[model samples]
Target: MHGQPPNILFILIDDLGAVDLASFGSTFYATPNLDRLAERGLVFTDAYASCPVCSPTRGSLLTGRYPARIGLTDWIDFGGRIQPARGKLVDVPYIRELPRTEVTSASLLRGRGYSTWHVGKWHLGFEETYPEQHGFNVNIGGGYLGAPGPGGYFSPFDIPNLPPGSPGQYLPEVLTDEAINLIRNRGDNPFFLNMCFYLVHTPIEAPADRVAKWEARVRELGLDRRTALVEGEFFPMEHKRHLRVTRRILQSDPVYAAMVESMDENVGRLLDTLEEEGIADDTLVVFTSDNGGLSTSESSPTCNNPYAEGKGWMYEGGTRVPMIAAWPGRIPAGSRTAEPVCSIDLFPTWLAQAGIPVPDRLLIDGEDLSPVLFEGAALERDALFWHYPHYGNQGGTPGSSIRSGDWKLIEFYEDHRLELYNLAEDIGEVHNLAEEEPEHTRALHQRLKEWRGSVAARIPTPNPNWQE
Candidate 1:
């Protein structure tokens, strides 16, 4: 709508659930800023991350290709402590770094004269493959690290790129300050700011004052009296078989709520900065998450009820995430769509917005979402697919899933078991219709298999070390 190209601000939160924000559905977390953003923009109810983990989905966001196609199918582990668990099937090896040969959204935008800046988490690769190498003009607080370093979300972050802060400065606030500085100092060129927050992830520490406030709120709401976590079956992975699956039943974790509030406050600050700098109308702000919430393990901070399981499974709760896009004049205000978009769409969407054509001889799996975002039209696609052939750190088995229209079919690699569900009828996926509807199951499974073959997806092999 502006004479010049619209500035792009993409805010990606790590491990945030489908309904983590108040605007989405959460009753415990306060996200007034995000709620206001939803009120002013289009809310995508059925948006999904390309993968259930962090690195793969983040790579897809930049490359416009599925993780399987790019050969980076899991979260890249820098410390080597969070190795993929093995049991019946050993996890397949994957690309450790995002290959520099691939064309990324940042690279394309920067070539077109846009000032691209990446702030916060850059777990895609190591020093050889960083944001600066991937087309960003400035990279802050980004490196091989996924979550905040040894210091957690507080000061002395241990992130090499980010400078030292005060003794107790929060990570999110510091990242936001850097982003605001970038926007304020930006000249005539349109900019692309990729703001990735490490909040609501592991090390769920928060400001003491905010944590205290939520602790009182939890008491006032009487949530402390209800059941919070439930013990379930043993983990499928061998490394954690001794531990049973622990799921958070309630969304009353005070520390996690505090982190959510801190993230919301920073988001508010970024949006306010845009308004204050008189660039609010000329910017397109998109907010989303890498994957679903951490609901089934590692303290099980938040619950993604109504959707079963969470991050690292092939369930709706694992991949389904919150997506909001607000452009003052382009995207309609207070609009909602269930068109089923994925993280891969961001690359092509950004290119289209910048009026740049996709390079010849390059393959892009994602479709351009300009019509859907700007014209309120529906996406024309057969289905969405996911392949995670490795046991999750949580309690998930190796599997690949396909969702066509409302029908979703998941095929487990370990036993070749098929589980089908009509998402329209069972959003929780509690009722498996694989046996009930043989025809639909067969059709969807066949399509999933064919798609995997086309993408050259690797399958896990039988592990020789398994005893049981």
Candidate 2:
């Protein structure tokens, strides 16, 4: 075994909801690989992505800073400015890429002689801000495009940094091959492999055989039920641009189920590789997602119900995600914790695990969870914050939120309105106690505001062009 400095394999899934896998409580989608990993690791029931979307949370995972503090508050749509038709406000300007100056965890680890590599979705920034520029010695399929590019989960992905694969090759499967190759060639250097799978994201396409299996399973289980119409905000897409209401509440889509299962298989493959290499105990494998499920638009693939709303909304369904950390003898096997943790914490935690010093010049918003993972200790902090000043494609409005203990408060910038909920009692976030508990609301709001001031969090201003 590799003694104290274990190799790090961070597997980040895009748009995989907290409840997407069997380990997380979803019956429709089967994720045996992830479930096995959970059984051998510390499962976090209250892990969160720094943001509800992809790019920002990805940045947080890398830099250990909140997206708001880093100025990459929204998903980087380098294509152009996304102006919502008939919307009340225009999205505020945001940093289009991960700044070069920021010291990412990969960079820090690489400095300590960890051979760093990144595969799959990079979405953090454009050409100059890619994984290689930051720290990764090898970058495969990491690019600006969020989803698997044009070919959509198949060959001819046209993804930058990736060589062309055989026709009809599955994206996730191919990415896993790349990761396996890296592991096989890693030699004696302790490595850090960030396997960012572009699975269960967009295009909602999967191998025909896998789809057929899920389709049969769905029918056998009598899972095909009428879709429910959840009460959510109504917005405009201008003609056929967007759906007025979010509908797909049931996770019965055969295509999405297939994608999830395929991703799971690759996860299992990677683990099998580790075991074959006799490095399973010497490797610290962490698995989680950048954000919650995508239930609102773009095929309305999966649902994150019981927590209210899905990807893009400030609700738990949007930010809450599955997190598992395993290091054979270090992290307790089959252990579970309810201590709240977020994407940012991985930065400091990984550094702490590698015995690397946190850069004194860099400001970090995330705390190390090594104590929790290794010793079952609790973090002293009471609250976590989120600031997203831009509208989400999934119909979430611009807002900022603070979850303090059991009570959570969300302040909408459009009308300066506040909504509060006791998450312990109302995990669905259905009942608002803003008026019922004025003092609690005020204190949470004050904290949220103070956090914004401290991080220089950006807030969207009134749009003069909108009509009431």
Candidate 3:
């Protein structure tokens, strides 16, 4: 632990909920392997993703900068404009690729002589800007697409970076097998492997047996569509076009449950591989999600109950994600913390762990959590902020927010309305306290404004063609 740099095994899951795993209070989704992972690592109870979407949060993790600062504010859609039928404003143009100029954690680690590898989803950019351009020595499965191919999660994937497997082979299993091969083949140099899984995302497909198992479990629990239905409002983003965003109140989708199970099983496979290679004690492992569960669009698979909303809103469920870190003899076993941390913190934390000094020139928004990980110390930061200026497919409008202590404030750009909630008292964000708590709301709003100005954040502009 002192002389040699520890090998890093980072597992990032796409569209996973804060409560999707049994370790995170999910009674329905069976995830024993991830639960075992929690038992051996440090669980950050209030961990949050930078943005409640895919590309922005992923950018935050790799760059240690806020999405606004990096100019990757929205999910990459290959230059598509969101022209709602009767919208008041148009979305600000965002960068479609992770800039090659910005130095990444992979590059930093690779510069130090570590072997860096990336496997699975690389939705950050087009094919030319894949992980290999960012610092990975080996790249697999990462391509221009954010999700599985048109053929779905099974074999014969249409993705270019990944080769076809047998007829019914699963994507997560294939990715894990590649990771295991890397772990076993590495000679003596320490490695940094980013294993991002495409499970639990849209076009949810699973093995027939796994789907049947969950279907039977749902029937056994007497859960039906009526009992699972949860209401969600698509706030007025335009005049008349309102997309229905209904979420299953419980984690009851047989297909989604099967996907979760598959991810868990493959996680077990990677852990088993580490133990088999006799490097389990010397490796640092991380498990987290790119965003919250997809409970707003496409099938509305799993719900993030008690947190409010999911995937594309500025609620606890959408932004809050599950994070666990394990390094034998470094992070205490069965450790847990309630301090709020976000995805931007990982780069600095990992660099600190490897004894590398963060370069002074970079504008890193994240703080090192090494103290909290090793000594359970409280973070000394004052607040965290988020700015999403585009109408999301999952019912969220253009807005900016700030979370300070127990109070959170959101300022809607469409009408300049403010909503305040005391998260400690109301985690679901049911009661708006903006009117009752004027001074507190004003303070948070001012800070959000200041942050936006500091980052030179892009703002949506009013459309002249609106008839309203």
Candidate 4:
């Protein structure tokens, strides 16, 4: 409560794999904006989303509470086609409306005399539980649905996903426009702007011109158009049922890269707005992701890199993500740290940075990382845990993972499979050291059991004919 509260610009990317960006190492795609931003900020190599899926991770980011603790153990599923009896229905789970009781990042920031605006995708539930109700004074195009909008570039609204937004304009452009206007209007008492981009996620909608450019390139390479991607963008998987074709789509096509590039362009726009507003020095801009990449099938998949699973699973690839912080003079530019951080940690950290104390009643399960972020504080935790009792879109299936130092223990309840890995050596989780390291496995298992016992996780009804 000393100096003026620093304005915050929190940019969240969707389903972006670390390997896809040029700065992270991919020469296949060009992310000039992101590369430049990293050069002028702190890049975290070990930051993580608390959960492996979208809503859960988003909830953790905003509330600093585990999904399980807040009645959101699974991806926020609803809408779509629901099949009776079978239970294998398609729904928009990311739009799971949160209960009113939960305190959010927006409400806290707004209460601290900050002008708040939320743009881009708001997949956290419905309007009743919209960003406006959560804390933000201004919420743009947010809804209680799956996609904030469409994935196509030209007529992004055609998908009729997040149609409440301005018609006939690029979604990214719209989000940036709103953010810039808010900055220009807020004559300077310090503000909190969450520019959550819906880009690089999916819907495979690239501008017609961009799509044509990619097609011509792929054709030049004589690659089969079936799985061919132009070279810098992600094309939507044409079919929903073809799950096996997902990996083929990502590797064979350049659509994923293209989508990433589109997202990067918007990043530059937002940054330029900040500079124009002359608040760059006092703002703490944070860039991170909702979860991991698509890896399952053509219908619903995400890439998790060296890790085995994508979004829905508690694998390193799914939970671990990039966390870049830019605070002109405070944070060291071009520095990278591997200290483990979780999604829930964002709750207290943001409040602390804004000099606002989180109400004790919130009962957050996260630790404040402001000391680590500002004063080079130490991070010492016995282990970080995950408990996902429901299955989700990222078809990596359902499981819980606990990481302590280099050791990770994963429990797959539905299959009754328990596995352990030494992540320091095996990043892909290829080796199951549970048998060889029985003692450590036993200890971690007991810890998981004890932790699970305390949380009132929903017990999934057993299927009598599950084996059949």
Clashes of each: 0, 0, 0, 32
lDDT of 4 by residue, 1-468 (tens): 337778888898877665556666554566798888889887777777877767777877888887777767655556544211111221212225677788987888888788888877777776678887788888765665456443354444533224444546777777677778888898756788888777766675656666566566656666544552212222211122233323423433446556676788888888888888788888888888888666654333234456665665567767777778888887778877767788888778788889888897778888887666766666877688887665544444455778888899998755557899998899889989999999999999888877776665554544343322
lDDT of each: 0.92, 0.88, 0.87, 0.69
Best by lDDT: 1
- For candidate 1, lDDT tens digit of each residue in 1-468? 337878999999999999899888998899999999999999999999999989999999999999999999988887766565688998988998899998999999999999999999999888889999999999999999878989899997798699978899999999999999999999999999999998878999998999999999999999999999999999887888899999998899999999999999999999999999999999999999999999999999999998899998899989999999999887899999989999999998999889889998789899999988998898888799999988888788889999999999999999999999998989999999999999999999999999999999999999888987
| Number of the candidate with higher TM-score, 1 or 3 | 1
What global local distance difference test value does model 2 have?
0.88
The TM-score leader among the candidates is: 1
- Using lDDT as the yardstick, the better of models 2 and 4 is 2
Candidates 1 and 4 compared: the better one by TM-score is 1
Better of 2 and 4 by TM-score: 2
Ranked by lDDT, top first: 1, 2, 3, 4
Q: Report the C-alpha lDDT of model 3 over 1-468, residue by residue, as the tens digit.
A: 277889999999999999998888888999999899899989988899999889999989998999999999888876354433125777787888899988899999999989999999989888668999999999999987878978789898887688888888888889999888998998888999999998878898999998999899898988754477656665445632455667767778999999999999999999999999999998999999988887766778998988888888888888899899998888999999988899999999879767788999998999999888889998899899998888877777788889999889998888899999999899999999999999999889989999999999988888787655
- Candidate 2 ranges beyond 4 A from true positions: 81-86, 228-233, 236-242
lDDT score, candidate 1: 0.92
Q: Deviation in angstroms for 256 in model 2? A: 0.3
